[model samples]
Target: MTASEPGTPRTGPHRAELDLDGVRDEPTFLDRCARDLALPQWFGHNWDALDDCLRDLSWWGRPSGYEIRIRGWQRFRAAAPETARTAADVLADAIEYWAPRDTPLTVTFDDQE
Candidate 1:
């Protein structure tokens, strides 16, 4: 469940962080994700769109290997628990879509406040 301990990076998967603090809503959450993930200009800012960009990772110019570590999620959850839960589910589905390809993208969520 944790992605690479806390502060160290091995010469393995490319790592990214998405901070969920103050993300209380879908639009802001998507915006933060796009900024953090370096998503494309044509990013639709929706669940399916996020899935597509995450699967491709073409915008960031990094391919195949990625570990997206999400933090501060409890702040968002405290503000809107349902929204946070739904977003997590959507992202998990996206990761699942790419996993079987052998170019698996891992998304690990930290619920600590």
Candidate 2:
């Protein structure tokens, strides 16, 4: 089970090839998350917010960050749908509030040494 691009119609194979930097992985983040969490597969509509959060912070390598955030958010939402909704609302508001800031946002992972 995999989440197709949000709002994009899916037909054909249950799995689709993700054109990553170059490598093709068998199970995409959406696929694995749906399988592991047993949630109705749905592409995250808030992908852009998640992507910006990741890129600004430079967490995992870009590829890994995409996978982690997508999967993590899916799992989170599945576990607590209400909380997820609240989080999404907060994130949206934050983006609007922060948009006018002149300084670039920076995110750092403490785990990185």
Predicted structure with the largest TM-score when compared to the true one: 1
lDDT of 1 by residue, 17-65 (tens): 9988778898999999889877889899998897778767644433336
| Candidate 2 Cα lDDT to native | 0.35
Clashing pairs in 2: 57-107
Best model number under lDDT: 1
lDDT of 1: 0.76
- Report RMSD for candidate 2: 17.1
TM per candidate comes to 0.77, 0.31
Show model 1 residue runs off by greater than 4 Å: 1-11, 62-64, 111-113
Runs of candidate 2 with Cα error greater than 4 angstroms are: 1-71, 104-113
Give the range of the ten consecutive residues with the poorest summed lDDT in model 2: 60-69
